[model samples]
Target: MKSAVEILSALAEPTRLAAMRLLWDGREHCVCELMRELGASQSRMSRHMSVLRNAGLVVDRRDAQWVRYRIAPDLSAETFALLEAALALSGKPQRVAA
Candidate 1:
């Protein structure tokens, strides 16, 4: 399990932070969706998701050749609140990219 410090540190990267913000809607997003929305290459997006996964902030499942991810549903209330606070403090409106 990742420590709280590790999780917070993961969010410090802009790509990971933006990805988390996109996933904050509490819905599943396919890798392709995230790539297109974030303008990230497949490998780059995968790397960012890996960090988020390691932090326990997100969960993913494979769908044939694709993968889908979402904010982890099993996060403790306290951890969830921390994520909520981080997103709130980001100062960016939550919306899917064009």
Candidate 2:
């Protein structure tokens, strides 16, 4: 498991933190969808996602030309608790229409 600092570092970025909130509802979100919703360019979004992925804060899978993201489901209780607290401080993320 990653240290607390690493995980916190991942979420420290505004873009990555927002992306996590979008995935908080447990829905798989495509990179393009996130890009559109977050107003990020493709390369920029991918880079942010890579940081989250590397920290094990998120996971992804390929779907044709797109990649999907979601919060990592296998987090330890401790990590989840920490994240919950951090997110609580950030307020609610805007909802994306289905």
Candidate 3:
């Protein structure tokens, strides 16, 4: 059983939540694009991405040197609803600041 704390912790950070919003808006985003928009170091963004991935809330696919991350489609209904509602609350703003 997944801990609620673990899931909430992964969503707690503003940057991580923003990243999810971005992906939720675009469906997928390459690492460079994420870094540019989030103004976060590659390693930093990757760390959050890894956390999301580990929580089974996100999915990634590699295309050449680019890796794209997005909300995972295979999650349980509960998580999917949570993510959808969170993203909805996050709203559809333009690309984030660099």
Q: What is the C-alpha lDDT of each candidate?
A: 0.86, 0.88, 0.79
Best candidate, lDDT: 2
RMSD of 1: 3.5
Candidate 1's displacement at residue 71, Å, is: 0.7
| TM of each candidate vs. truth | 0.88, 0.91, 0.80
Tens-digit lDDT string for candidate 1 (5-72): 88789888988988988888778999999999999999999999999999899999999999999998
**Backbone clashes in model 1:** 0
Clashing pairs in 3: none
Better of 1 and 2 by TM-score: 2
Stretches of model 1 off by over 4 angstroms after superposition: 92-98
When summed lDDT is taken over every stretch of 10 residues in candidate 2, the lowest stretch is 89-98
Write down the TM-score for model 3: 0.80
Pairs clashing within candidate 1: none
**Candidate no. 1 TM-score:** 0.88
Model 2, residue 92: C-alpha shift (Å): 2.4
